[model samples]
Target: MSDLSGSERRKLEKLLGMGSGYVLNFSDRTFGDFFDEYRVEIDNEQYKTGGTSKANRMRTFWTVANNHVLGRVIEGLIEYANEEQCFGDSNPSLVTNCQNIAKRLLSDQPVAELDALTAISDDYDFEIVANHVREAIDKNQPEAALDRLHTFVNKLVRITCERYNIEITVDKPLNSVFGEYVKKLREDGHLESAMTDRILRTSISVLEAFNDVRNNKSLAHDNPILNYEESLLIFNHVAASIRFIKKLEASIKTKSATALDKTKDTKNDDFIPF
Candidate 1:
């Protein structure tokens, strides 16, 4: 169910023109069409009754919809209001208010971390895997996404290992590759904090345990899946680690570039007359 507070929902309802018997410049047909675009069935029998208003349908939807669907529907309504100028000159702050609501909604989601993972790489394979993970997250089904998340982490660590020219074989496991990568980072002096080192070291075990999760407790096999709460906890932990690693890689790249520029400047200065 959506996490939106009653106050938040009321604010959205008023701002989106759903406080009346209508929604943002939409007739019943257009309203249905809009939700259909998002693959949402707003005409569900459970949300309908004799002579029900669109406002009532939306209120019921908000109560029962998952956060991800709620976010999408809210965003769509906001966009529609903007495009149609539904608020007119009555409230100059309506657009901003709607945007703030959307931001608060997203703040509770793992979207930022997912965006970070995609930002770190643009490879098609990476995007495909990330999208699969995102779909599950959006549906509030982290347990179902565990296998894809494992694949994504394995791919990410493999890419990081490749950047440092670490040898990896097809049979190498995720934790093994990650451990080697962490070792190389420490050897090269990229690891500057004792705490960071400890965290990464601990993550090696986490990923090691994750392998059993994928094989035994995820969609990778027919075994019973992990529960939703534990699955979300694992996802958050891995996502945080990925965020830290991205920052580390960016720092390393910037330093390498700066050092290379200095070496070039030194070479130019040392060049004497032929």
Candidate 2:
């Protein structure tokens, strides 16, 4: 069984209960052997546990309020169950169904909460990166996820340059793209705040480090496996960067359009109509 911290276990327990919405009843006749095998001490004879003792304890933990929370819980549970071996050899059918549920949860079914990077950008690259990276995470393939995140950031830089008409090659590294973006923002009088300046500078450093991590550890070439926390760190940072860049591009376009509109109004009377 893969190591599960206390919090993950709690989250999984909550997920299992949401499946039926009604309190899932486990008979002492069928699941008893399985529960006994796992040494789960039942709290009451009147009520037996579902998958584990804690399963019953946390059964009513979540209200069936929304599918979004339910989906997240299921995804987390499936990942946890696969790792924890809670539904091992005794229940192949259950495991199969759980796996199916996880896949369904991940498939193009509109999730409760859309991933901002993919949903906001309207870019095919963003969609690909979000889907594949999530699949990697679900499968515990951190290396693959981190590699995709690296590529995601790279594509973001390319898209930003294309959208803004910035005179930089799409092939440039993130740090270089960041520098050019800042320069353009300044020249266009769009770099307005010191806070924005600090964020960009910090983001460039983060991108550089992320790039190095992908090169050294991810599928770029095999190395020591990356842990979950490290992978999550890189993923979140890259996501934030993507969201920030997209917003920046949007802001620039809005400002440019407004200026163009004003300029056209100013020149309207100067034109001679045939």
Per-residue lDDT of model 1, residues 1-274, tens digit only:
7788877877887787775688777888898898887666788787775336788888888877767667777877887877887878656676677677776665568444755545247888888988888778776678998999998998889888898898889998899899999899999999989998999999999999999999999999999999977998998888889988999999999999999999999999999989
Q: What TM-score does prediction 2 earn?
A: 0.57
Per-prediction TM-score, please? 0.70, 0.57
Residue by residue across 1-274, what tens digits does model 2's lDDT show?
1223355444444434534432234444533443343223334443333433545533422232123233444555555556665444535655555555545444432222225446346777678777886656545345556777677667667666655576666466777786777777767777779888778778778777777888887877778647756775666666666666667778877988999999999899788898
lDDT of each: 0.82, 0.57
lDDT (Cα) of model 2: 0.57
Best by TM-score: 1
Q: Which stretches of model 1 miss by more than 4 angstroms?
A: 1-103, 110-112, 119-122
The deviation in Å at residue 270 for candidate 2 is 3.0
